[model samples]
Each structure stands twice: as C-alpha cells, then as structure tokens.
Target chain A: MEILVAAILTIITAATPLLFAALGELVTEKSGVLNLGVEGMMVMGAIVGFAAVHYSGSATVAIFASMLAGASMAAIFGVLVLVFHASQVPTGLALTIFGIGLSALVGQSMIGVAYDGIPQLHIPVISDIPVIGEIFFSQDGLVYLSIFMVFAVMWFMNKTRAGLILRAVGDSHDAAHAMGYSVLKIRFLAVLFGGAMAGVGGAYLSLAYSPLWVEQMTAGRGWIALALVVFASWKVRRVLLGAYLFGGISILQLHAQALGIAVPSQVMSMLPYLATILVLVIISRDRSKIKLNAPASLGKPFHASR
Target chain B: MLPRLIKRQSPSKAMVYLSPILALLLTLLASIVLFLIMGVSPSGALHAFFVEPISSIYGLTELMVKATPLILIGVALSLGFRAGVWNIGAEGQLILGGLFGGATALFFYEKTGFYIIPLILIMGALGGIIWAGIVAFLKTRFNANEILTSLMLSYVAALLLNLLIHGPLKDPDGFNFPESRLFSDSALLPILYDGTRLHLGAVIALFFVGIGWILLSRTLLGYQIKVMGDAPAAGEHAGFSHSKIIWTTLLISGGAAGLAGAIEVSGPIGQLLPNISPGYGFAAIIVAYVGRLHPLGVLFAALLLALSYLGGETAQMKLNLPVAVTGVFQGLLLFFLLACDVLIQYKIRTSKKSESTIAPAVKSSIKSTSEVK
Candidate 1:
C-alpha cells in the first residue's frame, strides 16, 4: 500500500517538469508554430534558474528569473522564424543547439552548487487522509500548479478571445491576415509563453527535483516533453495525461530496480523513452484522426509578400 | 515611396555558390561577437577556433579522426534530405549499429580468424539498416511524420544502448563503469597511419562519399528522389511511389549512420561507453544542411565541422574556453546558412508603401480569430 502511494507520488514529482514543458509547447504548437527548441530552452532555464537561486539565495526569484530567461529565448526564436521567415524546423533546432551550448558554457562553474528547494505545501484536512492525500496534496507547489495550469490552458484555448486568435493564426496565416490578425505577434506571444513554461519546468528540475545544478541536468526530459506534445495530439488535457503516463513509466523503472527485477538498470532507465516512442507509434497509427486536430500551419513559415 | 528593386527572374548561378561562403563569413563575424562578449579578443578567438586546431600534425590527425563519423553521417543525411525524407533518428540507428557491430566483435574476441573484422563491418551496416527500417515501416504504414518519429526514436535508442552497456554488455573484468568489453586484436580496425589515430574508417567515409555522389547523380533512383522532393505531385504523376522513396532514403541513410557508429566503436573507442557519441547524429544534421545536401559538398563541410570539434578541445586547453563552442559554431553556421537559403528562394525587396502593406498583413494574421476554423 505504501509502495502504491509512493509510486503515485513519484509519478507526480517526475511529471511536473514534463507537464510544464509539454503544456507550454502545446500552447505554442496550438498557435501553429512548432518550436523544437523546448529542450534547449528548458536546459537554459535550468541553468539560469539555478544560477539565479545560487546567487540571490531565493527560490521564488529563481523561478521568476527562469520564466524571463525562457521567454527571452523564445522571443529570439520568434524573431527568427516569425519575423525573418526562417524555416521552422531548422530554426527551432538551431535554437535548441544554441540554447544547449550557451547553457552549458554558463553552467560550467555551477556543477555542484545546491539550492534550497521549494517546500511541499500540504492542504489542510486533506493532509491526514490515507493514500490519496499523500499522493495528491503532498507534492511541491509546482505539481499542483502544473495540474491547475492544464485546466487554465484548456479554458484559455477554448474560451478566451486571445486563445481563439492564436489558434486562427496557426490554422492558416493567410486567412488570418485577411481577417486583420497579427500572425507574427500571436506566434511571438505563444513562443514566449512556451519558453517561459519550459523555463519553469527547468527550474523545477534544479530547484526542486534534484535541488542541485549539473551540466545538461535536464537530460532528455525536453525531448520527452516534445514527444508528449505529439502524444497529446496538441490538446491541453491530453498533455497532462501524457506527462503523467511518461512520468509513471520513469518512476516504474526505478521501482522495478528496487524490486530486484532481473532487468538491467540501464535498460530500466530507457523505459520512459521507449514508452514515449511506442505511444507516438500507437497514437499516430490512425493518420486521419490526428490530422484533424493538428495545427495546419504548424511548421510552415509565414511570409507576407503582398 | 522608395523605388522598387528589380526582381530577378532567377538567382544567378554564381550567387548560389557565393551564398554558402557569405553565410560562413557571417557566421564567423557573429561568433567573433560572441567571443568579444566573453571578453576574448575576436582575432585570437578566431585563431583558436579555426587555425590552432589544424596547425600541427597531431591536430590534423585528430581533426581527421573526429571527421570520420561526421563525414559518414553527413553523407547519409544528404541522401535523405535530397529525397525530402528527414531521418532525424540517425543517432539512434548509429547507436544500435554500434551495439550490434561491437557485440559481434566482442562475441568473437578470442578468435584469430581473418573474417572477424569483415563480419563486424557487415553486421554494423545491417544493424543500421534494420534500425532505419523501423521508421520507414511506420511512415509507410501509418503516414506518420518521419521527423518527429525518427527524432523521438533516437532517445529510446540511446537509452537502450545505455541499458545494454550497463547490463548484459557490461565489461566483465573492468570495475563497474557502465561500458562494454574491449574488442580483441582481430576486431580492431587497422590504423592507416603509424603515428596518427587515423584508421580505415576515414577511407571508408571518402569511399561512401564518392559512391553517394555517383548514386545521386547517375542513378534512376536519384532522379526519383530529387523529383519527389522538389515536386511530390509531379513525381506521383510520373508513377513514383512516395513510400518507396521514403523507405529507400531512410534505409540508406540509417545504414550509413549505423556503419559510422560501428566504426567509431571498433576503430577508435574500442568499447561501448554510455555516451559514445557526443551527438554525432544530431551534429550530422548541421553538416548535411550546411553542405546543401550534396555528397562532395558534405565532404568539405564534414572536415570543417570536425575542425570545430578539434578546435573546441584546443580552445579548452589553451584559452580556458568551454567545449560548448563547437556546438555554438555549428548552430550559428546552420542559422546563417538557413538565413542565406531564404535569399535563394525569395528575393527581398524593400519599398516604402510595400513594406507598410507587408506589416499589416503580418500583423493581422495575429489578430483574427474567425480564420482558425
């Protein structure tokens, strides 16, 4: 019973960063721009956030600083792809490579620094409940915020006028232009939001999860978040489910190792990644179904020549 | 209103060649700015970045050594890019190929047979082909986006490689450092030069480049690939199957990437370490694009990129620069190249009234909500 509760808790903790990143990417893609630099942005966030916390000795400031760092990086991407009419695929990838390199260079001195992590906030009354309370209400504030952000994102996308405009820009920039929409501005905002969220996700890793800075510390969680965006089929609610599923797979590998399972620890570590690919394969099997939900102009660059 | 710049019917052929050079120069200028920001002299940094790495015999050999896998992967990627089939998972395929080829060599480590090395090479290529075939299969069967699928599969492959090295393939005699057993004498790639680390892999890369050039230019398959990439509808109208092209391109590229991975393990590293490739698969993407998906062009780009890798190490030792400079340069080069490529396809005209008209169109696309449906 304790193991079950622990597993659920592990899943939530593991999913938090991915949740933040995928949700951010989801919004970005929903606006019709595929920002492949999420991984790079996340790493930059992790490093910058860690550096901020290390220098200032404040976790709140670090998280906010990370958001700003991530947004700025996204803004650069926006300038390249949205304004300059650069190819989306390569530009996003270059942003990632650039981000990773910049982060690594900046993070060289911060290899072993430790930061005071954000504390878990347990809800009153619910804290005393058996397994459910421990699983749901006992995580750090970021975990709850990630969950709340999903609902918030879903509502914003479905209900808000701004969300509607963003979606319109993504669907067909030409038509949106005809209707007096600013595709570049909407994409810029989406990219910034995505980058900020990715940064927050990165902060969760350094400030909360490991509570220590390491070079390339986020590992491949950024890639996993990118995969989650695809697995979610570009929906806010599905991103939450996908993040949790991947998180569960990640935790399961550790649990399996602890259980003295015959599988190698290295192989176990690959579970989440392999599961992501498998999920992508399964989800992508029905092409027609996925095409309906995908942003039509997701990877196409908007060039206004008229 | 400003006078409109005359729109050329087509870009001059000389400009096509000049663009990449201009892009390279722009990249150097941008990197100099980066160095200045880092408080390093731009000229000294450029010297450290490009010249210092290839000045000595040892540095030149090291550059060649690093260039081997990159050349192979770049050539493979060029083939696919030319066909419009983006096999971004070459890194994964390479790892899997290394695992297979390395395992083969390890399996026969005690044998002093003549065929051991040859068998490893074949198995390495085969391993890559099979790995690539997975992506090809998915694309054909499900109409999956090859870019995301292949790229995602790479992480899984890397993890699987890590698992194998730390578990079943763990070096038995060594302390518990997650690595595979060293290849026996027969399994090791014979060094070409006595004093240098340069091996048969470099020769193999050049050979493949030549072969790729021929295949891309002289073969019917090459024409089909080019047609499919440039005009997919026309290719279909001409009775060419997109599925066939995708499979062919991915398999060929995957096989090449796998071969490079195998060669790295067997020839140079001699063992399967957890992170054997410092993102060679990913780096090859830059090499492929920077080379403009041409075989001979990829050869030069590969050598240049390899210099960056070598320069990164030299910079690390001499100037206290981080190794990330190589990545930064590669990314910057690609960014500049892509920026240059935009000029190849579209001519930029700056007219006053036209510029204002463009801004509103660009702006309006961000405002309209009714167009989403």
Candidate 2:
C-alpha cells in the first residue's frame, strides 16, 4: 500500500508538467496558431526558475520568473510568425533551437545547484485521511494548479465570449476578420498564455520535480506533451487523461527496475517515446476525426488584408 | 504611423537570392551586440569566431570535413522540405547509419577485404533508410504526423546506440569503455589529401550536390514534388501519388543522412562513441533553409554553417567563450533568415492616414491600391 502511494505520487509529478504544457498548447492551437516551441519554452522556464530560486530562495519568484522567461521566448515567436509572417513550422523550430541554446548559456553557472522539492499542500482536516488524502490532497502546489487549470481551460473554451472569438479565428481567420475581430490580437494573446503556462510547467520541473539544475532536464517531455495534445483530440478533459497516461508510461521504466524486471534499462527507457508514437498513430489514423477537431487554419499563417 | 505590410502581386524574385545574404549580415550584427554584452571586444570576437578558423590550410580542410556531412544531410533535407516531407529525424537516422556501418566495420575487424568499405557505406544507407522507412510506413499506412514520430525515433536511436556501445559492441580488448573498437584500415575512408584528415567523403558529397540539382531541376519527379508542396490539390488533380512522393523524399533524406554518418566514423572519427555528429542533423535543417532549398545554394550554405562549428571551437580556445554561443548564433541566424523571408512575399510600407481603411474588407471588390498613394 505504501509503495503504491509512492508510485502514484511520482506519477503526479510526471504528469503535471505535461498537463500544463498541453493545456497551454491546446489554447494556442484554438487561436489558429501552431507553436511547436513548447519544448524550447519549457526548458527556458526550467533554467530561469531554477536560477531564480537559487538566487532568491523563493519558489514563488522562481515560478513567476520561469513564466516570464517562457513568455519572452513566445514573444519572439509571436513577432516573427504573427507580425513578420514567417512560416509557422520553421519559425517554431527556430524557437526551440534558440530556447535550448539560450537556456544552456544562461544556466551554465547554475549547474550543480540544488534545492529541496517544493512544499506540498496539507489541508488540516483532510490531510489525515488514509489513501485518498495522500494520493489526491498531498500533491505539490503545481499539481493542484494543473488540475485546476484543466477545468478552468474547459470552462474558458466552452463558456467564455473571448474563447469563441479565439475558436472563430482558428476555424477561419478570414471569417473572423470579416466579423471585426482582430484575429492577430487574439492569437498573439493565446500564444502568450500558452508560453506562460509552458513556463509554469518548466518551473514545476525544476522547482518541484527533480529540484535540481541540469541542462536539457526536460528530456523530451515537451515533445510528449505535444503528442498528448493530439491524443486528446483538442479536448480539455482528454488532455488531463492523456497527460496522466503518458506520465504513468514514462515512470514505468523506473518501477520496472525496482521490481527486478529483466528488460534492459535502455530498452525500458524507450517505452514512453514509443508509446507516444503508438498513441499518435492510433489517434491520427481516424483522419476524419482529426480533421473535424483540428483547427482548419491551425498551421496557416494569417495576413489580415483589406 | 504604424508600419504595415503590402502584399506583393508576385514574390520578389531578387529577394529569393538576396534574403540569405541579408540574414547573414543581420546575424553578424547581432553577434556584435551579443559579444559586447559578454564583455568581449566585438571585432576581436568576430575575427576569432569567423576568420581565424579558416586562416590555415589545415583549418580550411577541417571546414570541408565538417561541411561534408552537413552538405550531404542538408541537400537531402532540402529536397524533402520541397516535397513537404518534414523529416526532422535525420539525426536518429544518422546514428542508426553509424551503428550499422560500425557493426559492419566490426564484422570485418582485423580482416582486409577490398569490398568492406563499399559494404559499410551500403549498410549505413540501409540503416538510415530502415529507420526513416518506419516513418514513411506510419505516415502512408496510418496517416501519422511524420514530425512527431521521426523526432521520437531520434531519442530511441540515441538510447539504442548507448545500449549497443555499452553491451554487444563494447571494445573487448580495451578497458571497459563505452565505445566500439577502431575500424580496420580497409574499412576506413580513403584519404584525399595527405597530412590532413580530408577524405573521399567530401568528393562523394559534392557528387550528390550535382545529383540533387539534376534530380530537382531536371526530372518529372522533381516537378511532381514541387506541385505537391505548392499545391497538393493540383498535384492530385494531375495524377501524382502523394504516398510515392513521401516515400521517395523520406528514403532519400534518410539514406543521405545515414551515408554521412558512415562517412564521419570512417573518415575522421575512426571509431564509434557514445555521441557522434554533434547536432549535425539538426543544424542541417538550418542549412537547407538558408540555402533557399536549392542544391547549388545549399552547397554554399553548408560551408557557411560549417564555419560556425569551426569558429565555436576557435572562440572557445582564444576568447574563453562557452561553446553554447555557437548554438545561440546558429538559432539567431535561422530566426533572422525566416524574418527576412517575409520580404519575398510582401513590401513593408509606412501606413498613411489615408491607408487606414479597415471597414472595406467586407466588400469583395474594394481594392486597397486606390488608397496606396
């Protein structure tokens, strides 16, 4: 029972970052922009968050710093793709490349810095409960925030007037423009929000997950989060489910070794990535389903013309 | 008045060739600012980073050595990009090629067969093809996104290489190092220039440039690829097979990347290590774009990008700068390049008060040209 609780905690730690990033990307794609720089933004957040915590000794500052770092990266993407009309695919690729390099350069001095993981929530009355309390209530602040954001995003996308405008822009920017909506403004805001969320996800990794500074520590989780967005078919609830599923798969390699499984550790490490490809293939095989859910102008550049 | 973009009636033909040069100059200017912030004299750092690396004959040859793999991979990626096949997993395919070629070299370890070198090259290409073939199969068979699958496979390939080097292919004769034994003389690429590490692979890469140019500019398949990228509906209407193009482009890229990997191990590396090619696969994507996706253009772009690698090393030694600066510079170059490409399709103009009309978009016949003056 104790071991199971421990495994669940690890899974939560693994899933929170994916959840944060995918939710952000979900919102971005809904605004007619496909930003593939989540990985880049996440890594930037990780370094900045770690550095902030190292210098200031405050997790709150670290988290905010990480978000700003991510947003700044996204702002660069926003200028190039939104204003300059650069191709989305290559521009996103450049963002990832630049983010990784900038993070490495900035984090060079912060190597070997370490911090104890962040404080977990302990509600006075509920904290004493056995399995349920420990599993659900005792997660770090980010985990709770991740769950909260999932529902928040759901409500925002389905209930809000602004959300409809964002969706309208995504489905057909020309029609959105015809309706007197600033398609670019809505998208730029969505992209910034996505960047901020990705930043928080990065902060969760450096501040709470490993609680250490290492270059490239996100370790392809950003890419996995990207697949989760697809696997969810652009639905908020499904994204929550997919993040946990992928998180569980990613942690299986660790548990397999603990359980004395005979598989090579390297082979086991490949599971999450392989699972991602498998999941993508399955979800993507339903071409019409993907088409129905995917934003019609998802990767197309928008040029508002008279 | 806010600056606004006016759509060109047709893309500027001059910008097609000129944008890369503009991007390069902008990158150099950015580098000056970056260096100034780092507390180094901008001119000294720029000289150390760019000119000092190619000052000697050996340095120039090393530039070619670095550029060879880049040229090979860049040319193939350019073709794929033209065909709308984004195979970003060339790095993984390259690693697989290295593993396959290294295995063949190991198979002929201590043996001197004349055909071993050619056999190693073929196996390397086969390794890359098989790796990329999975992506092709998935995309064509299941309609999977090639970008995500290929990128995922790269991580897998790296882990696979790690596993083999640590276990089955570990150098038995040496201390338990996580690397394979050095290849025999027959398996190594033949030297082109004595007293320098220049090898036959450079010539092979140049040969592919000619081949890629001919295939892209002079073939029916090339025409089909262009149509598919520019207008898939039109290509389908014209009876071209999308699946066939995907297969052709992916295989060519994978094969080229794999061959480059094999050449690296045979030519300069001489043995398998835990890490090989040092991000050559990712950097090739930049080369393909900066070269304007033209074969002859890619050749020059490859050389310039290759100089970044050389300059990074020189700066590290001379100016006490971190090697990560190279990656930063490379990314900045790509960013600037993409930004400049906007000039190809639009003319930037200052928005005049008379040109501030926004409500006329609803009328289909309202032309913006009347407000331009």
Candidate 3:
C-alpha cells in the first residue's frame, strides 16, 4: 500500500508537466491554430526558468521567466506561420529544432548546475490529514497550479464568452472570417497562451522534478504532451486523465525495475513510448471521435487573403 | 494599416532562386549579433565560421564525407515530401540499416570476398525499407498519421540499437563496452583519395542524386506523386493509387537513408557504436525544404549544410563558441527561408490608400456573435 502511494506521488510529479502543456495545447487547438512547437517552447521554458532561478533565486520570477521565454519562442513561430503564412507543420518543427538549439546555447553555462527545488504548500488543517494530505495537500505550488489550470481552462473553454470565440475560430476559420472575426489574432493569442503553459511545464522539470539543468532534459515529454492532447480528444477533463495515465505508466516502469523485474532497463524505458503508439492507434481508430472533436482549422494555415 | 499583400498570378521565379541567398545573408547577420553577445569579434568569428572550414584540402574532403549521407537522405526525402508523405523515421531506418550492415560484417568476421561488401549494402537498404514498411503499412491500413508513428518508431529503434550494442554486439574483449569490433578491410568501402576519409559513398551519393533528378523530371511515378500531393481526391478519381504512392515514396526514402547508413559504417565510421548518425535524419528534413524539395537543389544544399558542420567545429575550437551554433543556424536559416518564400506568392504592396480594404474585417468581427446567437 505504501508502495502504491509512493508510485502515485511519483506519477503526479511526472504527469503535472504533461497536464500543463497538454491543457495549453488543447486551448490552442480549440482556437484553430496547431502549434507543434510545444516541445521547443517547453525546453526554452526549462532553460530560462533554470537560469532565472540560478541568478535571481526567486521561484515566482523563475516561473514568469519561463513563460516569457516560451512566449518569445511562440512569437517566432507566430511570425512564420501566422503573419508570413508558412506551413504550420514545417514551421513548428523548425521552432522545436530552434528551441532545442537555443536552449543548448543559452544553458551552456548552466551545465552541471543544481538548485534547491520549489517549495510545497503547508496549509494548517489540510497538512494534518492522513493519506489524502500526503497525496494532495502537501504538494508543490506548481502541482496545485497545474490542477487549478485544468479546471480553470475547462471553465474558460466551455462557459466563458471569449472561449466560444476561440473555439468558433478553430472550428471553421472561413466561417469565422465571414462573420468578421480576426482568426489570426485569436489564434496568435491562443498560441501565446499555449507557449506560456508549456513554459511552466518545462520550468517544473528544472525547478521541481530533476532540480537541475541538463541538455535536452525535457527529453520526449513534450511529444508525450502533444500525444496527450490527441489522446484526450481535445477535451479538458479527458486531457487531465490522459496525462495521469501516461504518468502512471512512466512511474510504473521505474517501480517494476526497482522491484527486480528481469527486463533490461533499456527495454523497460521503451514501455511509455510503445504505450503511446498503442494509445494513439486506439484513439485514431475512432475516426468519428477524432473528427467530432478536432478543430477543423487545427493545422491549416489561415490565409485570410479571401 | 499593414501593407496589402496581393497574390501573384504565378510564383515568382526570381524569388524562388533569390530567397535562399537572402536567407543565407540574413543568417550571417544573425551570427554577427550572436557573436557580439558572446563578447567575440564578429568579423573574426564570421571568418572562422564561413571561411576557415573549407580553407584546407583535408577540410574539403571531410565536407564531402559529411555531405554524402545528407545528400543521399535529402534526395530520397525530397521525393517523399513532394508526394505528401511524411517519413520522419529516416533516422530510425538509418540506424536499422547501419545495424544490419554492421551485423553482416560481424557475421562474416575475418571473411574475404568481393561480394560481401555489395551484399551488406543491399541488406542495409533492405533493412531500411523493412523498418519504414511498418509506417507505410500502418498508415495505409489504419489511417494513422505517418508523422507521429514514424517519430515513435525512431525512439524504439534507438532503444533497440542500445540493447544490442550493450548485449549481443558488445566488443568481445573490450571490458563490456557498448560497441562492436572494428570491421575487417574486406567489409569497408574503397577510399576515393589518399590521406582522406572520402570514399566510394560520395560517388554513390552523387549517382543517387543524378538518378533522383531523372526520376523526378522524367517519369510517370513522379507525375503521379505531384498530382496526388496537389489534389488527392482528384488523383484518386483519376485512378492514381494513394496507397501505391505512399508505399513507393516511403520505400525509396527508407532505402536511400538505409544506403547512407550502410555507407557510413562501411566507409568512414567502419564499425557500429551505440549511437550512429548524429541526427543526419532530422537534418535532412531541413535540407529537403531548403532545397525546395528538388534533387539537384538538395545536392547543393547538402554541401552548404555540410560546410556548417565543419564551420561549427571550427568556431567551437577557435573562438570557444558552442557547437550548438550549427543547430541554431539550421533552424534560423529554415525560418528565414520559409518567411522569404512568401515573396514568391504575394507581392508586398505598401499602398497609402489601403484603408478601404481593411474596413470590412473590422466591421465583420462585431457581427460574429450574432451568427452564433
């Protein structure tokens, strides 16, 4: 039972980043712009967040620094895809490559650097609870923020008037354009929002998760976040579930190895990736489900020339 | 008001040729700023980056050595990209090809036969196809997106390579290191020049480029690919098979990438390591785009990009600049190129009288909520 609780805690730490990133991307896609630069933005956020904390030693400033770095990366992507009307897929790929390279260069000085992690909340009564307190109340500020954002985004995307405008733009840009909506403006803002979320998620890696700087430290978590957005079928609630599910799978592998499973460690590392393929295939099989939810203008470049 | 962009009746030929040059010049300017930030003399840094790499004959040979794999992969990927098939799994395929080729050499350890090298190359090419075949099959049968599947498979391939190198393929007497024994002379590719690593692979890459130019410009399969990419429904209606194009392009790209991998191990590397081909696969994607997805263009682009690899090393050693500069340059160059390509389609007209044109968009936004109501 203790093992299960520990595993769950590890899973939350693992999943929170994915949830933050996926939630941001979900909102972006809902607005009809497909930004494939989540991975790139996340890495930039990670490096910037680390450098900020290393210099400033303030957690609040670090988180904000990550968001700005991610936003700047997205702004580059925006210039290419939005203003210049470049193909979204190629532009996003370029952004990611650029991000990875930029991070490597920027974080060169921070290599082998370590830091004190972000602090966990210490509420009075909630801190005294038995299993629940250990599981939830005493978690870091970012974990709570991530959970709050999930619900907040759910509310914003579903109940708010501005959220409808974003969704309408994504569903059909032409129709949205016909009605006089600035498709590019809405999509650009959505992209920025997505980038900021990805930034926070990336900052979590350096500030909370590993508590150190490393080259390409986000690894393939950014890609996994992208997959999570799809696996959830672009639904906010489902995205939360998908992130945890993947996080669970990831920690489960680590636990299996620790418990003396005979599988080679390299092979064990492949479980999450293989499972991603499996989940993707399963999700993609239901074409209608994907079709019903995926924004019609998700990846298509909105020319606005018409 | 923003300058009104008007669509050209036809793509500007001048922009098509001029954009790459502009992107390169812009990249040079960006490099200057990057250098200034690092407290280095921009001119000296530029000299080290662009001029120092190919100033030596040996450096030139190394440039060709790097260009060989890139050109081979780029030429092959161009065909697939043009046909609307995303085969990002070239890296994985290359690894498999290298693994197959390396395993073959090890299988015939100490064996001497002329047929052995040719056999290994063919097996490597075959290995690439079989690896890519999984993506083609999945996309055709299950309607899966090749982009995601191919990427996932690449990770799997890397792990598979790690597993083998650490276990079965570990050098027998090398203290449990995760690498294979060096290839016998019979297994290695013949050298092209004395005192240089340049080998038969460069020549083979050139031959593939020539073949690619011919296939793209003078074949029915090439026409079918273009038609399908531009209008899939129309191509389907006209009896062109979508599945056939997908399989064909994926196989060709996979085979080419595989051949590049085979050549790398047999020619320059001459043995398998845990990680082979430092992202020649991803780099080739940029090569294809920067080349405008043309075979001849990819050849020149590959050489230029290969120069960046050498220049990066030069900069790192001479000025203490990080080698990550190459990746930054690559990404930046592609961004500028993509942005510059916009000039081909739209003529930027700075008209003072553009206010009338911009009025409708402002008015229509206020009307959007009504339709929803």
- TM-score of each model, paired residue for residue: 0.92, 0.97, 0.96
Clashing pairs in 3: A32-A170, A180-B364, A180-B365
Best by lDDT: 2
Model 1 TM-score on a 0 to 1 scale? 0.92
Which regions of candidate 3 are displaced past 4 Å? Answer: B353-373
Q: Residue by residue across A1-306, what tens digits does model 1's lDDT show?
A: 988887887888789999999999999998889988888899889999989988988778888999998998888888778765677877888888888888888888898776668878777989769887777677787887888899999999999998888899989989998898878788889999999999999989998988887877887788789888888889888898888888888776768866667776666776776676678788888888788989998888776544
Q: Tens digit of lDDT per residue, candidate 3, span B265-313?
A: 9989998898898788888988998888999999889998898888889
Q: How well is candidate 1 docked (DockQ)?
A: 0.65
Tens digits of per-residue lDDT, candidate 1, B187-283, equal 9999988988888998999999999899989999989989998899999999999999999999998889889989999988988888878888888
Instruction: Summing lDDT over every window of 10 consecutive residues in candidate 1 chain B, give the lowest-scoring window.
Output: B1-10
**Candidate 1 Cα errors over 4 Å, as ranges:** A122-133, A258-260, B1-15, B352-373
Decreasing TM-score order of the candidates? 2, 3, 1
DockQ winner between 1 and 3, please give it. Answer: 3
Q: Could you tell me how far off, in angstroms, the CA of residue B71 lies in candidate 3 after the best superposition? A: 0.6
How would the docking of model 2 be graded? high
What is each candidate's fraction of native interface contacts (fnat)? 0.64, 0.78, 0.60
Stronger candidate by DockQ (2 vs 3): 2
Candidates 1 and 2 compared by lDDT, better number: 2
Q: How much is the lDDT of residue B41 in candidate 1?
A: 88
Candidate number with the higher TM-score (1 or 2): 2
